[model samples]
Structure formats: C-alpha cells, structure tokens
Target: MSQYDHPTNRDPSNKTFEPIEHYGVVGNLETCALVSRRGSVDWFPIPHLESSSAFSRLLDGGGGCFAIQPVDPFESTHRYRERTNVLETTFQTEGGTLRLTDFMAPMTDGESEISERTLFRKLDCLEGNVDLRIVFEPRFDFARTEPTLSATTEGVHATGDETPLCCWTTFAAQPFEIDTAASHATATATLTAGQQEWVGVSYGEAVAPTTETCEQALVETVDYWREWSHSCGNQAECVFGGPWHDLAVRSGLVLKLLTHDETGAIAAAPTTSLPEEIGGVRNWDYRFNWIRDAAFTVQALSNLGHTAEAREYLSWFLDLCRTTTPADLQPLYSLHGESGLAEQTLGHLSGYRDSQPVRIGNEAADQRQLDIYGELLLAVFEATRSGITLAETDWQAICEIVDYVTEIWQEPDSGIWEVRSEPLNFVFSKLMCWVALDRAVDLAEQQGFSAPLDRWRRHREEIRTEILDEGLDPTGSYFVRSFEEDDVLDAATLMIPFVGFLPFDDPRVRATIEAVDDRLTSETGLVYRYDGPDGLPGGEGTFLLCSFWLVDALALTGRVEAAETRLEELIGYVNPVGLLAEEVAESTGQQLGNFPQAFSHIGLINSALHVSRAKGMAVPGTELIGIELGTGATVEAVRDHNHSDT
Candidate 1:
C-alpha cells in the first residue's frame, strides 16, 4: 500500500511515528509545539507562529526534530495540567515507567513585552532503571539552511542562518556531539527510580539555564497558569458545569495559545499546509489572522464573561483601521498587523501525508468576503453590551464598514468558506449583510451616537427581504447555499439563527437546521462543510466546526436531549489531550487539517455554552453544578430533564 493510504504519526521517512491525534500541544502564547505521544517535538516554529520553522518533521521527513523518548517499546498516555497548557505524558516500559512534562514559560499577566523564547521539558523515572535517548536538531528556514552546531560551556548551541538556539541537559557532563550527516546533536542517558532531568532550549539570545533554574521555571509557570485561569470568575455558575468545566477552560486556554500577546491577533491555526484531505491540493496556510474568525472568537470569549480578549482585539482592530485604507479591508492580515500576505508554495519539503503544494501565505487574503462587516459589527455590539464603550473614532470606523457593505451587499464575492470557485450571491453572505446593518443600528441607538438610522434600517429590511425571497429553495422547506446555483445545502447556513438573522424557533431556521443535519451529517454525526464542488480537487473530511454549530442550534431550539447526545459523541473524538483539529475523516476517524485549530475549539466553547444555558444554567459568571456533562452522567438522565421546563 502507498504510504498515504493510512494515517501514521511517522513522516514519510518510515521512522517511528504516531498519528496526528496522538500529539499533545504546549504554547507560551507567542508560539507552540506539537509533542508526540512518544516524546518527539515534531513541529515547532521559532520566535513566533509565522517565523521560520526549526522543527518541521511534521511536514517533511528530513525536516528537523528534537526528540526525547525511551529507547525501548512502551505504552503511553498523556494529558494537560489541570486548567493549564502544560502537557504531561507517561510512558510505561517493561523495565520502568517514566513521565515527561513539557511547557513554554509565559509572560506574567499585565506584561506587554516578549523577552523570552524558551521551551522546557522534564523527565522523571518513577520505577526501575530506564535508558533514554535525546536528539537535538536545529534546521533553519524550513530545513533550507543547516546551522553550525558547536559545544558551549554549559551544553551546546547552533549558530548561523536564522535565530540561534541554545540547548542544555541536566545529566552529568551531558556529553553532546554534532552529527553533520543527520544535522543534529545526540545524547544518551540512564535514570533510576526517583531520578529526574531537565532539558531546555532558548532561541534568540543565549542564556545558560541551570537545572535549578529550569526546575524553578516549571513551578512558577504552573502557578501562573493556575492563577490566570482561576481569575476567569465565578466558574461555579457559568455555562461550564460539572464534569465539562475543565474541558471548557482548556478550550479557552487553547484559544489563548493561538493569539499573539502584543497584537491580540488570533491565528486560525498555528501550522500551515496541513491538508484538509490526505494527498490533496486543499492545504493552505492558516497562521495569519482572519478578521471574520477573530471577530467570532471575540464574541465567544465575551459571552463567557471574559472581556480581556475582546478589549485587546478591539484595540488591535482600531490600530488596523488607523493605518489601513478604510475603503478596502482584506480577509486576513499578518500577526504584526501587516495587511499583505502573498501566497507561496515550498517545493523542497514534502507535505503532511504527502499532500503536495505546501503553501506558506494564504491566497484568500485578496478575495472579497462580505460577511466580515457583520461579524465585526456584531462583535462590537456584544462588547458594548458587556460595558465596553468604543471611542468616537472607533465608532466612526465601524460605520465605515457597515456603509461599505450597504453598497456591495448585492455583489457576488467569495463566501465564508472561501470557495475558490466563481463568486456567487451566497445566501450566508446576504444574511450577514443584514446582520451588519442590524447591529450597526442597534449599536448607534443604544449608545445614543450615530447618523443614518433610517437608511440603515431600510437597507437591513431590504437585505432580509431579498434573502427570504430568493435565497430559499423553491420547495420552501430550507435555505440554499447560493441563489445563483442549483439547490445545494451548506452547513454555514445554520448560522441563520446563530447570528440572530431569525429566531431559533422560526420555522424556516428550524427547517434549515434539520435539512443540514439530514443531508450533510455523516454516520458519526459529524457535519460535512459542504457537498458540491468548491474549486478544489480531492475530497476532504467532515468539518468539525460545523458539527459543533449544529449542537448549538439544536439546544437553542429546545432539542436539548438530542443536542446533549450529539455533543457527548462529538467530544469523544477530540484528540487524546482534549484538543481538536479543523476536520476529521469519516472513514477512519483520523484527524485532518491543522492541529489545535482555533475555530474548532471556539466552536466547542460556544456549543458548550449553549447546551449549558439551555438547561437553565447560569451564564458564565455564576457557579453551576449537578449537570452530568463530562461527569459520566448517563444519557438516560439527560433525556429526563426538559431544558425549557426549568
């Protein structure tokens, strides 16, 4: 069989590998690394998310990797530190059992500057003697440049051609050697029961961290995370209750990992060019921040009474407006606020699963997606409701976005999914155009600040009328993906009730939800993003985000029992460490696309909120308990409680 015929954690090089779902993630807010179950740091971008990669083994066989694992075959399991991003994995071999903990130290709360670029891993032997191997490789610029590895007084350092990295080990003398043939440094050690060792890597400036310093950093980092998470406020009563509380908090932390601390721009996902389908051209870079996705992220966090994220993004958005051309805004921008991101492909490196055309920048940055106006305005409106008042200048900027949509709402453009096909008058786009006008008017009137109320109201009503009249199927039973195409379904149209274009119980919205679930849902209850041609070759997996949206829709429409059942099944498919990818293949239940996807986690947060609130639980600010979600509560018990009756 061809290598791509099935999923494996190993790269095409036929080395020891784990499947994508077996990896756990750790981040320090600036960047993240994917650590396999067996303890290989397969993917890591140095300095920042969009920076040149230092460990690209997840994408290419010869791409660099830093791995530390037991030399013997072993059984293992992994999990994150409670309410923190730190990951812990345990490997049990016939001779001994060992545990490895991984993390990147984070900046303290209220600190705005980034002064450290360090990642730490600690290994402890809990049982008999165990032999271990450590490999440290530094391949600069996506393995295009090989750094010169030299021994340092403390350990070793790689200099030349990109950011320099310093690595140190706690083993006695920890002898290190440069392996030019493999482009890596190798070390081996043995540990007895109760023995521990620390390994650290620092990018940018060289800092020799002793074993004592590394151990102290671990303690401080754990305390920092626990404190910050506890400050999420009144968790006992909020949308997260019972067994699912930590899962919700973990989702929130994952979203935080994807966000740039100084800029507040949240990436769609950290890695680029992971395919939506194996061996397909559907791979695209998702490291940059999309305005639509970021805005939705702001709204989701705000609903949980977490206003700090919304405040930061609002500041970032205002900064963009001040420097950018007001009349033309692109769909995405670089993390540092740069507006241009030209798409490019790397031919030298093999893609994950052999998916070709590994892309760097996104081409969709140039495409016109009209729905962002509504998404941005709605986020602003939600923030205002939470007592965040925008400056007059910021308010003016919002009006410009709304005004632009009024003139071009009727024009065809790339819809929300960024279909590469011909632009059409997509129903979802028109519906959001209406949302733009609706929220703009609401913000203006509620804040007692604005002009053109009559014009805005009229435009909103007109867009609503147009969508209802032309965007629905001729059968009058459900909404169509686009007015200019054959009657086909899109899971995105489920947002009709989500964005408040219509009430949840509105007959049309209800029918649309039912229609999507019936036709687009897989046997596993995951939703396919869309079924028709999308200007790409090869089939993709079921879109995990859309399935979460269906969960919210069902709960909101008083189908709480069904929603709970679906949600329980959905959560079971999350990665081993309570993380999620952008999509999941129906055939094998293997995770596809980028790992630790922001959209997927955001959907989880929002869907959980809906399920919690529909059952009469308090919104995120109060203490709630006794609901069996995530707590091993039986499905029969969930069926007995009527959410509306509470």
Candidate 2:
C-alpha cells in the first residue's frame, strides 16, 4: 500500500459541486440526513423534516455540515446494511482501507413512531494505517442563527437554540477544536489496522449518549430493520418476484422514511429548495405532504402488502375530509394537516450550483388541482380492497367528493402536472376526474353503500365522452395534453391504460405511448414529463417517475423484453446506495431535483412489479439470519449475506 495525506476539507473552489446523486440517505424516520459519498452530512433536518435544518451545506457551501472522512487521496464505494436503511461507505486508501457505517437507530418496539434524533456513525480500519478528519457545523433555521460551540466531557455541545445538539465519540476528545468564527468544530484522528471508533450526534432534549449506549443503539437499529424486512414475508407471495426484490424493499423503506409516522402524511421528498433545473428558478419546498402524492404513495404501499401504511394514510385522509369540503380541499397540507404553507424565498444563501432564491414553503398548496380527488378516491378504493375496513365517515367523505367532481368536471383547473398557466381543459385532469367517478361508483356497488349510482354513472360516461371527443387529437390516433392544444404529446397520457381509462392494447393508448417514446424520451431512455411550458421559465431534467411509467406501459402492451431492458437501464440511475432523485439531467445524466424522492421510488416499485409479473419471474428467496451486533458478529458479515442474496 502507498501513503498520502488525506483530504481534510473540501477544496475551496469546488465546495458546492457534489452532484445530487452522489449522496446516500440515512434517517431515523423522524428526520433524515443526506451524507455525501465523500463523507459529509450536507443536508439534515433537526428533530423532523418540517423543522429547521441544522446542516444545510448541500444548499450553500458555508451553510453547515458534519463530516468525517479520509484525509488522503482515495477511492471509495458504499452500500446499505442488509435489509436495512443503515449505510456503509468504504474508502480504499494508499495506506489502508477504512470503512464507515452510518445509521439512525430505529425504535426497538418496532412501531412506526420515531423517538430517536441521533445520527450514529462507526469507523474501522480494515488494513494498514489511515488518517481521518471530522467537521461538525450546525446552522439552525437555515443558517440564520449560529450556535456557540463548547466542549464537554461527554463531547462537544452546540448551544444556540432551545435544545442543544451534542456530538460524542468513543475516543478521547483531544483532537477536537471549536472554530468560533466559522461556527463549527473540527477533529483529526489516526487509526491503525484492526482499530475502530464510534461517533454520534443527537439533538433535542435527551441524555448525552456514552460510547457503550451508542454501540447498543446501533445493534438495536439493525434488529429493527431486519424484523421489519422479515415481516414483509416470503418473496414468492409478492406480485413481482425477481432479482429486483432487494431494490424494491429498499424503495419501500425510502417511502416509509419520508412518511410522518404519527400523522401518516408522506412528503414528496424530505427536502426543500433543491432545484428541478440547476441554476434555474424552479426550486420549491417539498417537505410538506401533497394530497395527490400521498394518495399515490399509500396505494403503492398497499400494493406492496404493507397495508398498515395504507390504513394510516386513509386515516389521515379522513381527518383532512373532516376539515375540508370537496370543493375547497387544498392540493397539499402540512404533516399535521395545516393548509397554509405560504411560499417564501430565503435570500440569504446561494442554492445548489448557485441556483438563486432558495425557497421554503410551497405555494402550490393553494392551487386548484382537481386531479387530487381522483388520487384520493383511488387510494380509498385500494385500501378497501386490501381488507382495510373504511370508516363510515370515510365513505360519506367519498360520496361528497364524488358529488363535487360531478359539479366541477366541466371546469378547467390545475391538472396533475400542477401547471401555473390559466386552467385549460387538460386531458389528464379530465381522465382522472372520470377515474374518481368510476371508482366511486364501484365502491358504492361493492359495499352496498347509498351513493347516487345513476348520477355517478351518467357523469362518468359524459366525462369519458368528452375525453374521447376533445382530449383526443383530430385523427383520433393519440390523446393530446389538453383540448386547447391538440397537437402536443404528453407523458401523462401514457397513464390511460394504467388507470383503466382505456385498455393498454387500445390503438389510441398504444399510439399515445409511442408518441411519447418518440418525442419525450432521451437517448438514455429517460422520459421528460412534457415538452410544453408550465408557465415557469427554466427547463427541468427528464423526470425519473415518467420513465418508470413508460416501463409499466411497455410491459402492459406485451413488450416484455423491451420493458425489462428499460427497467434494468433505469435501475442503473439509482445512486450508489439504491436511492433515486426526482429527475435526471438529459445532457449530463446527473440527478436533479430533491434527493431520495418518494415519487421516484414509488415509480420504481410499481413499474418493477408490473414488468416482473408480465415476464413471469419469481422473486428469489433468501434466508435471513438476524445478526446480533453486540455479539462480536461483524457488520460486514450481515452486508455480505444481503449482497450475495441480492
């Protein structure tokens, strides 16, 4: 092996240049941290996703960060702990091989409620000797407040806000130094072969953790994840069983991490202000829950046999219904069900890649998106089908929503895309409105509920006729984006078959899919959401979710081989640890938009399941041996088991 000085800090010139896909996600369900492969905790929310961020280096260089990485020039690789959300990154250096494990311990009771606010990390020297450095910086409230740092016998304490955060390590704290001017702390350490160290950071009111306690928490965290994975049951019983089983499970975990355990609210992503188009003005906060996104997420989880999540989301939905009329329902809400998420720009910092106007709350919450009714109805219908008994109150709300759809189906409103333009008769929106009535009529018939079936049937038929008449092009070969613009092709039209508006084999549906493939797909097979404007100026990357949609459409149309090939290619777009972002830049193939996007993962799960069933593949089953971490069993042993099976 060779010897060299490790890279202690990011180069001054390239501080904020890490690609969005270059990071891995680790969360304790209450909150999450985005750790770059280079070992920086760049983006993390304190206490919860909706709370102010304590580490915002991802958005701006000087914002804040907590990092521990090799100071030498080295190559590294990373993966998640087997069947768990824990992350492991290994650096192969000239002097030695160093492995770092990162995780937020899960609740031991194994319930969804998250009470842990600590991010745990362990470092081991696998060979020779290596040097490393650690940096801890906290910028509470988006860097508007700086914490005063002081060292304690337990570790370093950052006191500024009501609740202080403490960073503790197993080793003596001799190497640490408080950089008062920069509002951060730094440390350096050297490890020989076979040596290891444990470190952690915790916020909010809690006892300062000792080395032994952190170690025990790590063990419990592994057990928590393994039990949850085991609870998923045999792979043979899943709708899609193949080599993608592990990826699918990981995607499910990603979706779960973004959900608020208590309220069942699912955020679109666990981040805010990450740009859809780098250096463009399209950045918006996604930390809140959107009714449409959450509905789709619940349905996906239900399909994956995690009906608990589905039931929870429905309960949350019922709460929203109690406080809302169908006509006045907002498109999105805070995790606790607040509707006023006022949008604002934080002018203090530069965005990722110098993108300006870092945004906070989402203004789209107030948009008149009519497609959410369809999404909600579909979620309820799915939950009811999955043996989740809907409350009578839920049924009543469903009926009210159907009645509202009947009155508003003819009116133009923001479509599924949430375009800011004047409301036009978007074909996708009309199709989903039809879906609402169609599914509502079925629910009433199946449950023998007292819904006005005749009225619903009449309106459903009318909406279908209108779509066939106006939503379709003059040649009737394909559906257009909107009635006002009949020539434009839209990727959303490809959902015609998936939502049962038309059969996959229908010539019109097939032509629409082909049209999108021809016009919206890049050479790399990534699909654009659309080519038209959304009343916003900059261009966005190819949407990852839409690409997955194409995979499902391809499979449903009997193009099994093509769909399988496409699925494999899309899976390649996942980050080093199997997480996906909202979009990928067509020009560079770099991920864009928010990191670990729930919708992108949902698309992966749905499309993979669809294609796997179509191709007649069975999920390969692996025997899971729960490793007791404190019993001298190495973390690597568990990772090896999962890697081999996968």
Candidate 3:
C-alpha cells in the first residue's frame, strides 16, 4: 500500500486547513474556488462569489471539501496555463507521475455571454501506473444544513437547502459510494501510463460532464482567458516590460476574475473571514463590491488598455446612483448593486487557523467613507479621458455626486481604512474629496457639461489650503493621518503625490513619505496602514496595498531605483502561483488575510505603470489620462535640493 493510503492521511477527520498562500484560485468570472497544493477544493462559493460556500474547509475542519490526490506520497508543484486562468498541478510519486488540470469553464461560445457554474478536474498518468483517491464532501450553508446524498449513474448527487450539486466522473461504471450519515462520497481508481480520467461538478441546471465534454470545456475556457489577457495590451506593448511584465499580466487576470461579468462589480477578494491577524477579530467579509475598491480597479484596468471593463463598471455605478441620493449612497453593495449588507458571524465554524467569529458580511458598508466619491469621480474622469462617452443621465449623476461632495467634504467620518472608532477628520478622506472637485471641474470644462464649475474650483482650492494648514504636523514638515491624531503617521498619505494633490518636489510630500518610511515600515519594507489606535484589539500584518502605494510614492519622487528595489521585495511576497493576500506577516513572512486580494493587485498594476513611466518608458493609455510621473526635475536636481534642505 502507498503511504497516502494510510488511515491518517486518507481520513476526512484528519484534514486541516491549509495556509492562505498554499492555494491557487480558478474562476469563471462569476465565482471562484481555492484549490490547495494538496489537490483539495477547500473554499468554493456556489452560484455567486458572495453565495454560501459549497466547500468551507478553509474555515473549519468540519466544513466539507472535495479532494483528488495520489494514494502514494508525492511532491507537487503547480502553475497557471500560460496566459490563462487554467491551473495545472503535477505530482511526482514513486509509483509514477501524474498531472491534474483544474479550471472553471466559462461555457460560452462568445466573449459577451455569461458562464455556467461548473468546475472541471482532469487527470492524466504521464508515466507508469498510479493509484488515486477522490473524496467529495460539501457542507452547504456554512455547514448549518446537512446535505442529503444519493448515488447516481454518473457519480453522486447532493441536495441541500441552497442549490443541488452534481458530481460526475468518467471512470468505468462510475464506481462511487455515498456515506449518507457523513454527507460525503468517496471513490478510488488506478490508471496506467497515458491513461486519462475526468471529474466534474455543476451547480443548478448545468449538465453533468463526460470526458469529451470536459476536454471541450478546457479548450474553450483556455481560449477565453488567453484572449482576454491579450486584450489587456500585449506583453510586447506592456508598459511594464522586463522582469515585471508577467507579474503585471497575472495581476490583471486576478482583477478580471474578481469582477462579476454580468453586473460589472468587482469583489474586494474572493474569500471572507480570512483574518488579518491569526486568531484576531479583524476578519471581515470582502466578497461584496466596495465602491472605493471597484473605482480603483476600474482605473487600473483602464490604464492597461482594457477600457471595456471601465465602461461596464461606470454604467453599473451610474445605475446605482440613479436609485439613491448622494447621502444614501453606501460604501459597498452587492454585485447587483443592492445594499443592506448587515454583518454577521458564523458561530458554528472555526475561522481560518482558529480565528474566531468567521464573518459573512461587512458593517463598513454602513459607514460614511467620504473618500469613495473622489475615487468614483476620478474613475469617471479617467474613463472619459480614455474616450468613453457618458450619456446625459450619467453626466447628471456625476454632477449630483460632485455637488454633494461640496457640502460634506469638511465633515469628519470614517477614514479610508474604515476604523471602527468615532469619526475623525482623516487626511486621506479629505485629500480624495479634493480630488473629486478637481476632476469634476476639469470634466465639466472639457466636456462642456453644465455644472457649478466656479463652486467646485473654489472648494478645490479651499481643500488644498485646509490640507496644507491643518492637515500637517506641528513642525509643518509632514502630513498627519488625521487632524484629530496630529502625531500619528499614515501610509495612505503616500497617494498625495500620485493624485496630483502636490508636486513630487514639494517638501511636505517628501517629508510625509520619509515619515511613513521611518515610522510605519516593517523590517522587510512592507508598510503598515497607520500607527494609531483603530478601535480594534490585536495587531495585524503590514498592509500590502499600502506597501504598493509606497512603491508609487517612491518612483514618482525621483527615487526610481529605490522604487524598483522595493517593488521587487514586495513582489517576492506573492504566492508560488503569483497570487497576493491582503497582508503579509512581518515576523514569519506568511501571507495573512484574504487570498487573491483585488486591492493589492490594483496597487501593483498602478505602481508598475508609475515606475515604468519614471524610467522613461512609453506607457500606453497613460498619456490620455495625464498620469503625473514627476515634476520634470532631474533626479540629481531633486536629490540635491533635498540634500541642501537637510
């Protein structure tokens, strides 16, 4: 018998959650699954990204999973099929070598259509004979409801409260047994050299797979992903060329996967309740679309020459704006643009790595994040600059949003980090408010759209004056996190230069960057969001998004070489399959929080563009949007000025 055939490894009771970085993701642009290196589908939400998980082993041991692994002990390595989201895992066992290909097929004949909910797993014995085992266990509704299992001619059928799941295989006669008490199914098979087999599962009315159908699906899915990636500007034309080109493309692909194709909404991340600090209460759901995150995502994709996604997202946001007044606009919403995301905890399930109170929704949805208006308007401004025309109603929505910002920009509210403490006058929030008015005035003048341009211009200058005066430290050398916390340092202020709030050569911008570098940076150069109390207990890992923002800050200030080095160090934190989590542990270098985070990837894309531009490389689509690279001063001149100041 093989080593894996032993009771300890084969038994479901012995299963444990894998590290957040141990898994690679595959999706159909609607929902995604996290497949571990051990060949287990541990976290999969059926129907939609925000729907109840069909496989929740990532959260609790009792949460179910579907795994296919060699019966023999083996070492495995995996990668995505070139330019596509299809994942291939190769296992090297003493008995033989085997390859496992996993993907969620788009199931569409054309690019414009939506995809069916189906996952395919194909196996090939590349060398000698090999023995394999298949375990299918699904805990529907976060394990609250036990699914009724029945054997089928093709494989097994599981009926639960949400949706029925059908698992089928191509093995002869489909030999598998259902354990009704445990609510799981199991099967085993052995194949000789060059032999192949397939396993597939579908949700709802999708047809069960045969070997031929699975093969066809693989080809179609690969083609779809490759075509989509190519549309994001060919690698030859990629502004970020050299060692960072492939990484940039992969980040684009991840952002695309998190986006809902039908609704044009982008998820913050594919998973929920992955803790920022292990065993901490900082975990929150990220599957919903935050207007702040989606706006950033749209701008990043548009800069990469993928303007269609930008157009779609703008259309969706405008539709949402039409239904509500500016005061009622939520910080986040469902993929279909609905709000009311009441936060709740799944008490029955243990969180990832015993982090308690696994959460399902986000309370930050109800918080007043004034920064989203700036982000949304900036995205709209960039979209129009990229040649996307807005309809009259869309322009009307933009006007109302800008007008609303004029009234509330001075109010204290939740900062960009969504602190749970009482609202304070956050510098980042105020900065984005400035961005909203600046872009609004420019858009109105350029497009000849009627608006209160003079009022917007006045507010824009007033915001700049306020930030320069009260938003600074007592020494007046650096920007503070908020006016309330004058001594605290925040990394979000790194974007002041990127947003054109100040010239790169401005002494305050330089001082703010240096202050964050000295106070908030980890030993590994990763950046923490802030150094003040956030009303939450326990410390979290350095924020990846903030780290990338620092990268941009460095590059845009005459520190191109320093930015390149920091960019390389940050890229080293990506998982083996080129995915980034929300945060990275400073002590152990382990990734923490949600896997395949959209915000992190968005930051990487924008930073790459900034660095490339700083290096005097030609970046497409940036000229149209007027991305400020620097103050046109030579690096030596800027360095000399800083030296002389010192």
Candidate achieving the largest lDDT: 3
lDDT of each: 0.78, 0.78, 0.83
Model 2's C-alpha root-mean-square deviation from the true structure amounts to: 8.4
Give the alpha carbon lDDT tens digit for every residue of 259-306 in model 3. 998889999999999999999999989999999899888777766667
- The TM-score leader among the candidates is 3
Model 3 spans > 4 angstroms off: 1-13, 107-115, 231-237, 616-646
Candidate 1 lDDT, 12-40, residue by residue in tens: 23354356787888878788888887788
lDDT of 2: 0.78
Q: Which ten residues in a row have the lowest lDDT in candidate 1?
A: 626-635
Worst 10 residues of 2 by lDDT: 623-632
> Can you write out model 2's per-residue Cα lDDT over 292-342, one digit (the tens) per residue?
888877666655657777878888898888778887799988887888888
Residue 325's lDDT within candidate 2 is: 89
Residue 382 displacement (Å), model 1: 0.8
In candidate 2, stretches whose alpha carbon ends up further than 4 angstroms from where it belongs are 1-14, 107-115, 173-175, 230-239, 616-646
